[model samples]
Target: MSQETVNYLVNLLIGVILAGVLSQYWRLEASGQSLRLWIIAAWTLAAADLFFVARSMLPPDTLPRLIPTITVTCGHALLLLAAQQTAQRPQQRRVICLIVASHLLLLLLLRAVPAMQGWRAPTNSVVWGSLSLAAALVLWRAADHVRPLMRFPAMVMAFQAFFHATRSLLATQAAVDANPVRSAAVQMLGDVEVSLFMVALFVGVLVAYLRQSNDDLRRALANVQQLSSMLPLCAWCNKVRDDDGYWRRIEEYLSEHKVSVTHSMCESCATKHFDEFKP
Candidate 1:
């Protein structure tokens, strides 16, 4: 198959995989909403990839080039949002608005001015790199709260940012014109880098989810153990004082805590209460 055909098929497959993963996560009620944001990010990235695949199939200028650029920009923005959500950080509306507006302005410039077309690659690189770096920074700041495995995701984002920044520096028209072979090599390298980054991102998200689930399970077990421990009980009444300072009968307390108890009388209690019938 031709290179274009291969690229289209690969991107299509990636999109399908992302959609499947999103659907799987959607059905999981226990994953929580924040966790699902990662799946959303994946879907957005897949959409961007599909746009690229479509571009390969159609003739140049058949579709607005700006469409793919906007889609990719939105995908990167979603990645940053997902990272922020994962870190449990508050999303700053002002910052998000500014980023979106800047992207829109860039898109307008690209569409209106012929001269600005040459700068498109570098401009997109910078924007995408900045988003990736922001995600890395957010994840890094949340390192203390999350599991050690979270560092992998942060590192992956940082690597991606660095790669894009490097590309921006090397993607000049003069540089490409000077050495076509070198330019082609660099482009191929970027494709590989992006593929690797996607795999790392997916794996990191899965690891994060598993770690979160494990932590939740641990907390639940600790709560159960605490309830099973010694309680402050009245010596005569056999009533327990709970965390709220309310005294309740043992049966009532256990029932409230969702513990099942079988009612039974001890031998001494039975004999003392029924002396006439005692053996």
Candidate 2:
């Protein structure tokens, strides 16, 4: 029932999911490289959660608390990167770096001024919310063939974006009023929401990957069928050309390709080859 216990469970679940995702990445072919970014993002979030659970034990200073904030911000950024890769969009690396740099600068400024400590939560929320929204939009607006595969993950991202935005507003109010109970309540809600979102988003992404892989397999099979139908045959010899550019009897080619054939002569061929039939 305690928030701390809840956070511990959530973190443990994230760790398990992260491990499973990494194993999946390993089992997949090279095409699953996009999952690398997601793994990193999940790791970043796990680090943040670890810091969050241990925040009470940390020294009473802005620097110590900023660790979680920084990690969480980076985690969102990496998620956006993963989304872009999934959608097969050109990654705006420079823009992403600039945004991160600006956020770090803002954090430094906040740290310099003790009076502005309250704004940290809102600032972090804004960055996270914006990044989540961007990722959702990217997936939603992807190419038609890719849109269906990404739709669920996009929806999850959109929901998280809205959650973070609303949380940001609550954080602003809490900062302004210095309300401990409201702040604690917001934190609890955020922990639960984030845990749910992570589980859903990753599951959605894994499903999307499966769909994409299946589509690719179907297309490959279709191509193979088309190619098989169009095999090159000699005009005079009736021999078929195999993949190695060697021509062989049609029967041989068919047999090599695992096709079963039965020997049968047409009436015309039978009559032409027999003198009695010709009469």
Candidate 3:
């Protein structure tokens, strides 16, 4: 309820968002499709949270929970899509999209439920709990099929989601209709929840994306640098005839493939070409 606490949490969230962005740099050359999308979702959530925090600064009227409800819920869906992409199951991508769309409708209808407006106290904890559990299950499934490095990020996010679901259930059930202290605690938990969850997922996925990019880059560079070895020939004449019938200078052949060469006569070549000459 204190201004200092609110400012501190919001600032922390901002820091998390920046850390996530920095992590993306590492994926510069990777197949960053999924990673990029997830970071965008996180930054979007952070932006919305910032906006909510700003609105809360105005007055003590009923805190507008709608923006955050949409932001966080949609952000979670985006996170799931990203996780699925990283796991390389594009075939199941449409299923994930359908799930997201269904949730959007559910969340939209939540506005009619007066008690749901303030998540600090859940009038019906079971509904939210079940939904959160299902999302976690989906994330777990995605993790099951992902690569090792990506698996960690997915697991980290799943853990974050689990905690968030627990926090929601606890905060809601403890004070849905009763104590002020419990309500305040619920409010405090809600205040910090989005920030915490977004940071974990964002940081993990960004690091994974950047790493993927780096791997892709290294592979590409290796491909570019690869050359078929030429047959060993007399280094004296500078001719590099391969197993093939064609005879050509090694430097000339390499040049055709965008590889530059510097001319240098080796000791053997020097000795053979100028047998009687002094250095």
Candidate 4:
């Protein structure tokens, strides 16, 4: 209907796509079963968001009362999973599972009582703040345990949480007064918030993963390669020595490195050494 509404719809669809894509990516590259489960959890949250948008036949307050409860619940669940179980440490994973159960219990309580809607309003802020903090803590939580590349996804989550939290707070404020222009502005803002955060989080993690992969491939390649100039060898003795060690012949080391060689001898060496006939 309105430009704000259209933008909101567009952003919602785009965010869903991004979340699904990112989830799939995580599912594919994730090292552990728990990590893949978390990615699926994230996809679940994104699906809830889509459901919220689809069921918005009623007013915003009423629609949010259902879908957002599921969305926020799934979101926190997914984030906790990602934070603690990406690398699948059993102890941390247990803690994460506890946190998830606790958060969902809170959501269940809120759903049973409409008065808890106020509490739901602060959810985005709390979850985002928590996400940002959790990601930061991951820096120290298992810094010695996790790879730097593994940290990228958490950082992306942190940014996503902050954006969603701010958007939710602003949208709540906009909902209170029933101001037309402010409501429109809030809708526009939500679009921007959701779209950009999805892009940043998904694309950021993907790029980081690809870069890490490239670096690993390069390192693996470097291990077997030598960039140095060839060393002098004793032609008569058929010995080849590198900076590291002496080899019986050039063919020995070359075989390991996928190099092929053809045997050749000068006419003098061929006749003198092999035939033992000198002019």
Tell me, by TM-score, which candidate is best: 2
* Model 1 agreement with the true structure over 146-203: per-residue lDDT tens digits: 7365688889999999999988887675354665675666566665665677778877
User: Which residue pairs clash in candidate 1?
Assistant: none
Model 4 lDDT per residue over 33-131, tens place: 344554565566566556655666566555354655556555655555555554443335565566656666776676677655545545545654565
After superposition on all CA atoms, how large is the RMSD of candidate 3? 10.2
TM-score of each predicted structure versus truth:
0.75, 0.76, 0.60, 0.58
Q: Model 3, residue 170: what's the lDDT?
A: 73
lDDT of 3 by residue, 94-166 (tens): 6656765665566556556655545523522333344344444555565442465565555665566566567
TM-score, cand. 4: 0.58
C-alpha positional error of residue 119 in candidate 4 after TM-score superposition, expressed in Å: 3.4
Best by lDDT: 2
Report how far off residue 271 is in candidate 4 (Å): 38
Which ranges in model 4 have alpha carbons more than 4 Å from their true place?
1-8, 19-42, 58-65, 85-91, 111-116, 139-156, 160-191, 226-279
Error of 2 at 42 (Å): 1.7
The CA-based lDDT of model 4 is what?
0.59
Q: At residue 65, what lDDT does model 3 achieve?
A: 44
Sliding window of 10 residues with minimal summed lDDT for model 3: 120-129
Question: What's the number of clashes in each of the models?
Answer: 0, 0, 4, 0
Give the clashing residue pairs of candidate 2, or none.
Answer: none
Better structure of 1 and 4 per lDDT: 1
Against the true structure, candidate 3 has what lDDT?
Answer: 0.57
After superposing candidate 1 on the true structure, give the runs of residues whose Cα lies further than 4 Å from its correct spot.
147-149, 173-180, 229-279
